[model samples]
Target chain A: MTTTRIHSTRTPAFVEFQASPGHRRPVAAPSNVDVAVIGHSGQVGSALLARLDRTTEAPELPGLQLREGINRSRHLLVGDGSVNQQDRNPGTLSGLGARLLAGGRPAVIVDCTADATLPRHYPEWLRAGIGVVTPNKHGFSGDPELYRSIMQAARKGRAPLNYSATVGAGLPVIDTLKRLRRAGVKPAAITAAVSGTLSHVFTRLSAGQPLSEAVADARHRGFTEPDPLEDLSGRDVARKLVIMLREAGLSQVRVELEPVVPDAWAAALPGQVDTIEALREKDAGWREKIVEAQRDERVWTYLARFDGRTARVGPVEVSRDSAFAGLAGSGNRISIESAEGEAIDIHGPGAGVDVTATAVLADLVDAAFLLTRKG
Target chain B: MTTTRIHSTRTPAFVEFQASPGHRRPVAAPSNVDVAVIGHSGQVGSALLARLDRTTEAPELPGLQLREGINRSRHLLVGDGSVNQQDRNPGTLSGLGARLLAGGRPAVIVDCTADATLPRHYPEWLRAGIGVVTPNKHGFSGDPELYRSIMQAARKGRAPLNYSATVGAGLPVIDTLKRLRRAGVKPAAITAAVSGTLSHVFTRLSAGQPLSEAVADARHRGFTEPDPLEDLSGRDVARKLVIMLREAGLSQVRVELEPVVPDAWAAALPGQVDTIEALREKDAGWREKIVEAQRDERVWTYLARFDGRTARVGPVEVSRDSAFAGLAGSGNRISIESAEGEAIDIHGPGAGVDVTATAVLADLVDAAFLLTRKG
Candidate 1:
């Protein structure tokens, strides 16, 4: 194991650990806070590390010390700016969280990986009084049992666990839902265009582009996953829908995914080239559907809809003048209606490294505030 | 003088004073918390009181006790469900803040009044360690010096002062702006239609209704103020813009209001009949503009724009295919663009007694959370 030491030149300013404007003050200004970044070498993780690197100068987050940065092959320490090769990989990062808290200071772990196995460690870290902040959806959306345990652990140890970036990137979807629930206003329905990758592809298709070409365009624009099949399968949007339903106070959530791409084609795909060829094979079907929508003054969009009981995601036709039709490239829109028929609509970019990094940093600050108050 | 005692059938459950989903826990479950309502006789105030009345059974806010209910003519206590007329009035309610904290319990004041005079007492109450939550924009949008003092007092006494309802009712405009600032992202520009009354009237005009009929219809639908001039003058939206600008970290804000109704007509309006007649006289001018917009395939809307330095509110033309033109009757919309050009658009109803009351209740919960942590 490689050990790391982070020395923040500026004094730790816990006096500024506030949620609102100058309102919250901890009992004492804490001296040190250790932040361990798991998977900090990825795109968003590296952006977050860069932001944290500037915290000594940035007033938004005053004194967050980046204790360690762990990736696939190495765990780099910040002090002395040292880098070392790790004998073990991140799959065995079970005890790293426990070691972070050995100094008897407040510790927070930022999980920036999309690894499925990493979420299993969240409950342990949270129950041990270590804060957990993540933009990863696997933890909450993969297994419903895991979601319950994570929430339970946060309550048991009184540690803040924030994953606002899991669903809508930088959008306030989760926080808004929590606020509505806190005020005794339950949502009756949720209609959303959540996946920026699919949104971009379908928008191009609506503009008379070929399906294969649109997929390649989105891939070149960095909107799709390395494997374009991941974006075409509709599973990504389905996971987001599950997370949203649970946040909307639904105890038992079952989302039915009707993928725009046929499930069989996505399942048996071999490689990226084949994925493009497969998309080309389905061009005629999609073109016919698009022409039908055009004839009826409608546009096709991939949408996730939840009406109190049922949650479904698939390609749906909306009026040409509707908000969904007006969504441009890489945009996300959600219309949430309350039990009383009141509605609020939010629209913004759903995918970006900078905005997503900002969301993670915001969560880190909130976690730090929680730890400060604990002291 | 009359003294009121409030009893909660449920135990004071301070453990549930959480901002997230069961993530925050106070050190101790406080025994009692007193909530004093000032100006509880008005429309929103009465709705908030009714919601507080249901708190005994609602799990959202568990055990907040209503200690005092003060209107212009009387202050009634809740003990034994008694109501009595008082000799003294509310204008002299200077020392009530100190008295609420006399019992050694946590105290919070919910200001539901639009009264300009009551805000003068906010700093005293906040500095006394009593939380202040209000839907009243008068406190923050009035004298700039008072805004500074209220914020300073909140810091000095470490008490929460929340005014989220001041800007977009329950639409999360202020909170979103604060979040953007906290993430080190300052908005470059803001374009908003924040007044529901004005939005309704303009939408009606765009649909070819006469200006006088539109104003009268809005007033009859309870969308306008008691005096139509207040909404017609564009002052209401200007106040909201000021609050938004201040929250956006602008130190000095000056708003130039170009009313849809002519300044002279709104300024010297004698009564509602004259107000309607004055609107009638301006019908041809508005009709000409509307016809020109129709010819150009555009729609007119009252908009508030802030471009970092200058703040202006006036009538503007938007393309018929744009979101501003798509905004229906009584809907509010705000688009905030960050310095980096990232944008988030929020649309919803900006006015309603129930939603505004809900916003106040949400703030009350937040204040309760803050006070609970202090104990």
Candidate 2:
């Protein structure tokens, strides 16, 4: 700090402070990286398309309204002529060309599909060293073996798989978990209202709405999945719970979901939750239960929770003071307890085209920055 | 969509899916970049060192416990043999070396000092293409002209200046605002509790505590700056507001801050709050005011707010139902109004070393990733 003084006529550049090699060349321009957006027909998918196309209709896509100014992908292949939301076979999913699957240079794929079969191709993409940015939860919250496979793929590909939008849309659940893990704080417990649709139902039902009405409203407003019953079955919450647990370092915990409903109705429902018919409650026990909980000043929400030794997903009765109480429509809330016993709560809008698209856009930006590392 | 079915071998490598120029070699392992820690003796700087060294004794740091597993940067320079916390001369600041400034290749300078003079060196470093990551507020919120110089330097250097930890520690306020800006959502308004020390004081004061006791406690725990008056003064909050407004694209807005003096002390205190003697209210009117506010079920906290047309800072009374009613200790909160009327509230720990260091580490990671661009 005291020996390297060189007098200059003009204001000396700060570069004079560091050990700059005066003979080196400046960095070249950004690489010729291409971007391929798969699943371009869905809600978030369409919004991304609107953003890329410089249109104004993606109003529902949270941050899409502001991204038109700085979009840098020069070669944008939307669906590569005919890709759809359901194209999941290894051959079809892998056929988006090297820019999406395998590239000698850095490239990216904005995957928006919810197809369960697509996760089967994650390892291949990873192995090929292609970056993937997606809101699709299938690849992350699926089989525990697959989760490991995805991670291994990332290492093998020497590529980043940014799926921050998978767990809680734009709520930053994944990033926060990663930071907590990075900080050496093992999360002792993570309790979350993970299903935005279910949360919408609970928050509304407490304010004097029928269970069916709340579910229908959430579905009509596009808060629920394609199917309304998916919010009621507790499977979605269970998937999110497993992902949270895995992020917290409990990679082997497999949680077999117990439906939020009672045993009588659970038996009558189908293995799937794509329809209200699967929730066969003749006396409307679900509605009555919600109203009953409200009367006791207890808010009932579909909670996905893990406490180190156990992971469970079900409707839990929380006091009015609970972080989950009075959660607004389509909002997600997560409260994590560190090993040190201090708790941190992070809550935000968990779904909707805008929130999910903005999260996916964030991943896309990460992929863009990482692409310079041409593996 | 029927896809191209060209599968002759076992799970055709997704790598086979890309247009490979068989001539190119695999990416060389992440570049030979070096990292320099400028303020190694400080709390956050030491915590970062502990993380890089894989040690376990950074109890004051928020996230060092989790980062030990993945700390990379092989050529680490703790300090340039003579840099101290308060050395502010341009000659001293610029002596760190090329790797910390204009490197032959990509490199990073992790700035942790709060020295006002250090920011003057930023434009020169940025102009040289050296990456900058920090929690320091001086560079971003000092003079409007300097802010412009820094941005222009980033473009000139083709380097990134990441200061996400500046305004909200690890709460992601800067990132969120930038995202909103990118999405073309001109943020209409932003209201925040930017002072964790003041927030903590208000929260505790509402629960029955003397002003002096609160100040002494915060001082003892290192919540306030070395000078307790720094927390009482509105300077920190005002700086944060300017940064937030600039992020929202209001670069020209000049805010005249009115300090958070309670009604009883508004007319009694000196122009500056750099000493406890300045808070000489013989009857303890300040304490009684907090008590009176509590009686009305209203909580009071220092607030820094901007609503596009105006920016202000002061102690404001918020009802029990308001989000600001009970801020957690040393935590920050920001509520943003999008171009639309929707309000988004983001709150988290704002002042702890761990929180801020983790945030700086995130920017460090970003700088590392951006280095692959090779300016």
Candidate 3:
């Protein structure tokens, strides 16, 4: 008999057989579905474009046939989510978001842009029967009213807006919380090191490098936001925590504390990486901060914690045995204390164009299923 | 004007929110659908029964109003799965499995049993257009031919079979691999501490507990199989690894080696745990084995590994930094080294009637989606 198994060398008994059990028929691309993507040129956006533009690709689940490139009769836009003069849509996704809210046929919109103004339009899109999936965190975490509005829209639309990538990139944080809630498990607490940008910076800092050096490395490696200040300011991590809290049915969550760094240093920061040097130069106490940090073996991690009654996002010192201690560059780890009081940890690479894009694609599949279920 | 946010009590700036963004219309349960559950009397089965019977609860997902109890015509038999005198149509899951193939109305068959013979009928059930959601590992990790048969039936019937609970209870190991593969990240290797029983045994063993004492503790906690021999045998872990490998597109797996424990000791063991003392007494070298293990800090973990070309399941000494080393009792951890050279770790409770049952219910929601998609 022929030996078809790759690891057949390990076990001689594993011989090739013509037909094995448990086969699944792969789902093909959906036909004539009008889908539009709002962000195209950004990192995650470009990755999604590449995935969709690939000609010879494996079939995807939830069965989507992505017609990449911009054509707003249903388009996959990949820019800053702002509509151009060549299109019928405009603004922070409000154009298509409204289009979805004012729906006719079953269409879809996958958001890859990270603009705060765009998420305001999500409820309308969902309400109009448009399936929405995104990695953009601002949509869910920006304002509590906006968060409720989005959910209310979804409830009215009878659609699902998937934001699994919003919390831990490719990690299934939000989905886990949702499933746990649906299964009657109350999520008691959440301790997550979710910002890959901060994790990368801290990983380098933990390795005896100075804060500036770590920041420089993270910026160079494309892990930090173009503004670097946004990551260091802790706003990114705070937004992510807000989104997660809302999903756990602990809503109306607001960032309880400002960034741990001094306000003067953060306020002096410019809007982009062009001013990183100035931002660092203005921070006189960074070295002193390091000395205080090095006085102990505890590693510094920008953490988001919600203990049912309180939700806060700030820097915290985690010990060697802490799940957050071993977090490497751009990796996220979440230790969830479920209602059963079971503490579980899920870890993985939390950011990257490919990883984030993979999360977006998966959400597309989820949105498709949600659509089917709605029907 | 009202500060309704929970964390508002902690931070003064936090206030109540009127709305939020990114809404998802929660799906209600399906109406008037036929769902037949086999192995209804077992732990997971009973849990499923309780869930179905609790209809006055939250408008459950996809609007499925489960009519729980034993009705033989299309029964949710929560028992040993043996077609008793009460069965209307016996064998191959009664008329339920066959009805799915016949293709009339919407139907579902949730298998909660753990019998090798019972799973052999999954293919026929799936082929009959019946949705199958199961936590039973046997159906997937059993005979290679049977595995292929079930999959072929699913493929031919164009129905999705969900088995996420088969590997890591409520953890998303199978779903993670599926998404990764679909995104073109070939999963390269798997290193997992997959057995809760073994995890318990090892956790105790590492704490200087005698092998016999550890086995007794595990049995008392209900972590071990009723016949602790089945757990100690490593066969369970082997089967789980097979299912994982196949999900990563590596099929034709086989368990070529038996448990490391002496055949004389294991073979002489009784079916139930009434003779656990005899097992400890028969083991003439277990204490010495513990001393050897304690000489160094290396912890013994029942690890299952597949390194692209080789697959092995047995006891191995893991260093402190090893992912498996951190696993505690009833916990499961899987480290996947994907083709992208990323080692991702997923850890959580591996087993429990409640946890496994929760996973089954989630899959039921998924199966409902799959059914809608198929239509």
**Model 3 clashing-pair count:** 46
- lDDT per residue for candidate 2 within B320-359, as digits (tens), equals 6677767767667787765545555666677788777766
- What is the full ranking by DockQ, best candidate first? 3, 1, 2
* Per-residue lDDT value at B67 in model 1: 77
Task: Mark the 10 consecutive residues where model 3 chain A has the least summed lDDT.
Answer: A1-10
Error of 3 at A140 (Å): 2.1
lDDT of 2 at A139: 71
- Weakest lDDT window of 10 consecutive positions for candidate 2 chain A: A14-23
User: TM-score of B chain for each model?
Assistant: 0.88, 0.77, 0.82
Better of 1 and 3 by DockQ: 3
- lDDT string, candidate 3, B324-355, tens digits: 77466678988887667776687888788877
User: Who wins the lDDT comparison?
Assistant: 1
Using lDDT as the yardstick, the better of models 2 and 3 is 3
lDDT of 1 by residue, B245-278 (tens): 7777654657767777766656666654567877
Best first by TM-score, ranked: 1, 3, 2
After superposing the true interface residues, what Cα RMSD does each candidate give? 18.2, 19.5, 9.2
